[model samples]
Target: MLLPLPAQAAALDGSQLSLLWGVPFAGILLSIAIWPLIAPMVWHHHFGKIAAAWALAFVLPFTVVYGLSATAHGLVHALVAEYIPFILLLTALFTVSGGIYIRGNLHGSPLLNTGILAAGAMLASFMGTTGASMLLIRPLIRANDNRKHNVHVIVFFIFIVSNIGGSLTPLGDPPLFLGFLKGVTFFWTAGHIIWDTLFLVGTLLVIFYLLDRFLYAKEGVQRQDDPTPDTVKFGFNGGRNFVLLAAIIALVLMSGLWRSGISFDIYGTELTLQALVRDIGLIAVIIASLVITPYSVHEDNQFGWEPMKEVAKLFAGIFLTIIPVIAMLQAGTNGPFGAVVRAVTNADGSPNPAMYFWATGLLSSFLDNAPTYLVFFNTAGGDAVHLMGPMASTLAAISAGAVFMGANTYIGNAPNLMVKAIAEDRGVKMPSFFGYMAWSAGILLPLFVVVTLLFFR
Candidate 1:
């Protein structure tokens, strides 16, 4: 077992940190947004290095100013408390889901495509956004490979399956899971936000169906030669991985529900026994997937580690660079982002649900939504009981914002980027980082406004 650091070596005080400390985080985001568009080859080859450079840019300067011990503590806390668990769960999901290959192709009629999206939306809550996206994206792409105008299909898939669909259950998204770990009841989100989810999902589905119908009509009956003809009967391969997927879900649920009251302190970070068991269990699941999955399944699915690698490397830097940014936000009114914290409150000091919705959402668009949800959850007084009771609307707003608006940008959620990477790898010609934002701004922003008026207000 690891020994704890002295109590004096606690986390960095965001109240004392200057705004300049956020430069590296902004730099990384800009690099992600611009570099790929301007210089695709360089960005692809050296993106990890670029991410690492930005991370070092923050760490090196921070170490000099705050002393090595403080910087070390911060880094340890960020990794031990946040990043490692995050990547492990993602890895397990990616491996297990990637192993399951849906054989044969179904033509992507507008109605059929809409039905698949609807099914994926339902699956996302149970299997996780990452798992559901990986499981369904390949089949969706295969189904639509012949379509002339299919980009909208993929974009809407990201919006519906990978983000908004995950809103109803903690098992669906990271932010909600974090909320669960913080003592929110298991079904609280479903009970509170079911209507909001139904409205957004139902509306998006109708819009997708209509748009796809229009595009399908414009492209004529046969848009392009079907790259994947429906020659074989439709079926699933790697069926055992489904069992592993269930095990993954069980591990996650067990971690949240089982209280061992045992933990270790690595530097200043607390590592709980249930979390340790969950991580170890996930590792076992990943190994089991790779070992038991048939080689033919992997081949037919065209499954590769590149998408997972891209997500892991990029997020390593994001989680690292975001350290001081989270701290500053956590500092509340005293921090540089005091305006953001203040926007969620009224003059009489009651939480403003609409402002909470927008504030949590806009920031979650660029920043990591999980921690952003935590910041706002605490900002609304951190008592889950009170938030779930008198402040139920506020909690609901924060939850909805973090989970739903994650589709606004590619990097807003881990699965979004992974889906983009996989789609592009399969020759989908997906939109660029900013290009995706244009789609979201046009479609989702208007819907979000309606959501704010109808629900948050």
Candidate 2:
């Protein structure tokens, strides 16, 4: 039996809320960005608690001011409607990908590294970014273990495989999946942003090739003692997980395609039949991955729950704290974020494609891109048909920006940090938060400008 909500429950009005309500959101993001750099041990041990405290910082005061009913409604909506499904899909992908171990290593020549990156880019659009990253990152690291200048390789991996490579389809990234759920056709992104994706990814690949070649030669003919010696043969362990990965793709597609007019309302959040089935199926996939995969494969992969646990904890806080921030964005021209709305609109009141690209991309760099996509999407009138047709350029700009520029920061996408953590765990010294930005700012930002000019303009 379904339980009842409070009699006076209703949605929070963004127009009525002030910008002070956004503090916890900003605080948590800053903490994620800064805390680790300033105090690594404390942040590492207590990051989850820090995230929860920020979540409560918003919830407690909001409940006091708005009443318990409204607070409960907001929490339910964020958790049930958004966070649960988001994390479940990520978990399934992480688990299945973690199960499969690439058994042999290759020499990390610039050409071979580039080839692996290109292959990962193609696989990303099919398997999801997290899946592709988890499956390929270790092998790439193992291949490059003997090189003196290998940090660039991992950074480029995050750029190509973790972020930009995911631009081709909804399965590639969370923001795109959210677009698919919002009535976008299955192939809409592939059709709309194919050329744009090709330009950005191709250019980055060329740049990576040249830079890697330079560094490879600079390190001289002699190499360090190879930590992970290359095997004569290359193959995969836990091959069954590949089928589970395919099942995950099928389940995501089915949820988008199937229409059952059946849904249940729980605490003002609508729970649809297809969505429930998809989430349940994902749970099964996770269990099956853990059960069917051999322990040796996981041992070889060094697969553990730390990365997944970290993502889950950090994002739980992100989703909860972002409630009011998203509410304000939803309020549009009348809310605290009114200036953001006006920036993306032309003087003639038509949507400006370039502004949509930058606005969505910039905000997405700081905020979670999924909800950022939704915000700009609604600001563009929330008509899927219209956006897909007459305002196709506008939609393309938003889609490309959200998917591509997530490389701007580690927190821009979930997999960015996961890949970083994995790299660090493998003893690859990653750049600091701002240090990483120096890399993105120098490399990615210039390319984004070119993208803006070539495609967005």
Candidate 3:
């Protein structure tokens, strides 16, 4: 069930791509990492233009070398094959989840926060990292808003809800979704990484529980002005969007299960019928949720399009600029990045599942994990059948690495940044870029090492 490569008239030679082609991608990454700290006003106001500049930096040179037609094919390939579907799915999840507000005035406690985190982790594999994050983050934040020392709640929220929770299914993480589209079965990830996921989630929950308990003890009592009533009764508003959420899930599943062999040739890229249906259906769901759901629901959720816009603009630059980098990795020993390829392989030429895990995870911690996953997947021989057969462990390693280590940094996945921005806007003073990394370095890295030894070994 491997999708056919686009029949491009003039395929760019990855071997011919110089390492300098990576500069634009690096530029965007640095901008994302550094600009927000050094010049917050400039980044907030002009980040889109900056992202577009980096994209054009890559696209312009590519057009000059590859001709307008081939350049059109590449753009079309990135959009049709990757970006459009990606943003649409995100939009659907963001919109649908935004409409359904968890209306309550409940105070957050160690037990309650951990319980909420555990529930969100379960919902992630089914609703998506983005969907589940959007649905739960505000509630979690609101629950702990009155607490004096509540930053760690948001941090662990990112750790579990935004990253590790999504390891179980394609719906959970973008990388897994890319794998599914590239012909990995839907349940393939759940089957391969079930134990690893459970172990990591269990251990993290235990650690989070201890940390929250210690912090809870320091807060002498709830603030005098805390609005959360002692006997608050919880209810869900915008219940209509729940059906729409189910529709989104159903459409995604349909795209995978019901391949009618129908497809369209869009500038040499083949867009299958089911894929088209899925995207169109998702778009419809987004529109319906926006139109049907009352504006009050969004207001209650404090929903704004700024975070979504940031993600879309930034990722547009990322998907476009990453072309050369992915091409180089796929080129293996024949390309400028041959050392990267060699490092992930055994001397016998067999795949090293452990190296694949760490290499993919570390890079994914910085790069967009979807394309990062694609690079290593192609490196491990892009045949889905073989990858699921003899190379199951390697695929599992890649899957686990890409999804889990996304918590290692803010931009590792889109939701991490979104959750941070949302939290900060709600008055949580989030850590600076390197400061956040300091948190992950001490917390997640050791846990990941243990996960590596226990499962990847």
Q: Candidate 3: TM-score?
A: 0.92
> Which residue pairs clash within candidate 2?
none
Which regions in candidate 2 have their CA more than 4 angstroms from the true location?
A: 1-8, 217-227, 366-368, 378-390, 425-429
The per-prediction CA RMSD against the true structure, in angstroms, equals 3.0, 2.7, 2.8
User: Each candidate's lDDT (Cα)?
Assistant: 0.86, 0.86, 0.86
Give the alpha carbon lDDT tens digit for every residue of 22-92 in model 1.
Answer: 89887887777668668989988998999999999999999899888888888887787777877787788
lDDT of 2: 0.86
Task: Put down candidate 2 lDDT per residue, 1-457, tens digits, no spaces.
Answer: 3344545366667788899998998888788767866798999899999999999999999989988888888888878877898888888988998899987868899999999999999999988888899899998998888888888999999999998899888788988876776667778999989988888789989999999999989876343467775544699999999999999988888887888888877888888888899999999999999999999999987888987787789878887888888778768789888887788988887889999999889878866677678778877766788888999999999998898888898878878888898889988999987889899999999988988898878
Candidate with better TM-score, 1 vs 3: 3
Off by over 4 Å in 1: 1-8, 178-186, 214-227, 366-390, 421-438
- After best superposition, candidate 1 residue 265: deviation in angstroms? 2.6
Which residue runs of candidate 3 sit more than 4 Å off their true CA positions? 1-8, 218-225, 230-232
lDDT of 3 by residue, 1-457 (tens): 3355554656667888999998998899878877876898999999999999999999999889877887787788889988998888878888898899887766788899999999999999988888889889988887888788888888888889899999988788989987887788888899999888888888888999998889888876465557565464688889999999899889988988897877877777789989999999999999999998998899988888987898899989988988888778778789888888789889987888889999999988987687678878878867888999999999999999999998899988889888998899989999987888999999999988888898887
- Judge candidate 3 at residue 393 and give its lDDT: 93
Clashes of 2: 0
